[model samples]
Target: MTYHHTQYLEDGSIASTLADLARAHRILELEGHGDMSMGHLSYRDPFGRGLWLKRGNLALSEVVDDDFILIDFDGNVLEGTGLRHIEWPLHAEILRARPDVNFVGHSHSHFATVLASSTEELLPYNNHGIWFAYEGVPRFADTCHIITTVPLGVDAAKTLGNAQALFLANHGIAFVGSTVAEVTLTGIFLEKAARFQVDLKSSGFTPILPDPEEAKEKFDRIYPPKAQHNFWTFFNRRLDRVEALQGIGISQISLPSAV
Candidate 1:
């Protein structure tokens, strides 16, 4: 398939967006979500159907504005240098399939990988875990090999369906969202929730779970526009504080009211 070598102009919104993407890497590292250079995050390019993702094999903390690459649905590197992630197809096919999703994050987070290796699925044992309780997060029950092929990416996207996240069987986690904040927050909290469940189950006791109906209710109220705004602002402030000490700038960018 043919792909365009798009130019990324660091203009108003694009500049702000790239800065947030850089800060997201730092936040993920601070949360212990980096597994060597295997993890990646991507957002749909505002200019086209292409995606902007960090270069391959770069530690999350090492990611910068120049590290971002533009690639198409065919996994062709249309812009920037350095290697692209081996699993770029995971982002490509998903974006092609789901118009609602603009941000995608894939990680081999410790707790998330551990939980995926088990037969048991993540249970909503508490408020933080409740968001995943409804459909119980989809599982891509296929091979654990890197999704390097378009067919593999398509299969993964099929498994994701309408869910917000996918637990790659015996691998890791892939999450989707309409905004960077939503995906980042979900990815972090998903790992935390998995860790909590695994620890609780290891105690050899039954953990009480919230009712599905009530859990969905709470999720609706807590994961809306207002809540995302508040959470994103709070985390961005933390990022700003860290960057300030190093003489870097990360302007606070707000999520759109609709996302």
Candidate 2:
């Protein structure tokens, strides 16, 4: 992962942040967040310029540090090359609303999108589901269309409130956190939790959810800051193995050849 020194990447901290953002893109892609080139991730500029977003026209798996463009709240690309995602406001207004958040990610993960289209709430049937059990995952029902306007973004942010993640009705999911690891993990776990509920429904078996107090207690004991760091480290190592296999000429995917 050689980072080319660009105007934004010249700053060590900014470079490292974007590097993490890029890695997060790939990590989420591996964890079932890929939807062609539609999804995106962003980092709030430390200097207060705006959010440094993953540029458009690239899939999550293909995002490198150089693929970012620094865009202000008004959709102005202040730095870097490539076109900015029209959903820039999705990141902008969230950062504006949540002073504590520094990272934002949006993706149409499979199970999450399925759960979003349905009225079913995410249950704490698994460890992954417990992360959002206390705050409760809220659905942004204002619109299922792309969040391209400031007002729409603001509405989405309002729906998000202080929760770590939001399900966009019939669309995707939005997740925010104070760091890249937390944001990325939110995206990953949200998808996993959604999958659990969706699959449990498909199994035709009633799910026995944990008590709310017990779930919150487990979340506190298991999801400490150190656990988040450890999970991030594990994902990075997993990514390393995948990339190493690709380096050896193994394809990340395989399909039967057409007749």
Candidate 3:
């Protein structure tokens, strides 16, 4: 059953989770990682049977304390401020498909869009891009308008199986992380990697590559995203201060409100 939003304010427990998500979204928006309101970021609350999320659109910049909407594993609006993201399935299904994840960030990053429009994988063009080494990126060349259906989200997530990132044809890229910080940072890093590739292509020069073992070592350093689950907590406290000044005072963080 869908968790309908009526008159329930996110309690301290749930509010803490929303605090993290809203702060993270604000950071991504401020960084100009994606267009305004075009990208979506979500985190699964540790409570509410682990079927709750903090998402939908409500101006990432203005989102403040306890302004995150909670949803089920099925993308149905449970509690928050607005309608779910157009590609709600993209976040819900993938989270369901992969129990290991807590954060899912979807955006039409400029560099990612450029690379997505191509048939190539994001190769390691520098020490930064070394993350995409021999581990080629998977592409979803469907050119579909939007992933509004569960099946579509499932298919796309499957295509991205076991990969750190994905390049969606004629669209953009998707980066998944176990935490909000990691997911947000990975999205940024992937764009950097894509930009490196684009620059090299423009110069018509082959960029030097790092050795396999060396790349693996770097990968391990960035792994576990700061002790697994802790990454989410780190950003939660960091963003709370920013949201407080935005005037997003206490309110029923209804789905429609936060969304």
TM-score of each: 0.86, 0.91, 0.75
Which lDDT value does model 3 have at 152? Answer: 85
Q: Give per-residue CA lDDT, model 2, range 1-259, as digits (tens).
A: 4222232223459887798788899989888888888899999999999999999999888887678999887889999999889999999999999999999999998888888887888878899999897888899987779899999999999999999999899999999889888999999999889887877877877779799999999999999998988788788778778876663212235322211
Q: Ranking under TM-score, best-scoring first?
A: 2, 1, 3
Q: Which residues of candidate 1, in runs, are more than 4 Å off?
A: 1-12, 242-259
Model 2 scores worst on lDDT over the 10 consecutive residues at: 1-10
What is the RMSD, in Å, between candidate 1 and the native fold over all Cα? 8.3
lDDT of 3: 0.63
RMSD from true fold, candidate 3:
8.7
Evaluate all candidate structures by whole-model CA lDDT and list the values in order: 0.76, 0.86, 0.63
For candidate 1, write residues 92-196 as lDDT tens digits: 889989999988989887777777777777878876687676667788878878778889899999999988888888788899888777787888788878778
Most accurate candidate by lDDT: 2
TM-score: model 1 vs. ground truth: 0.86
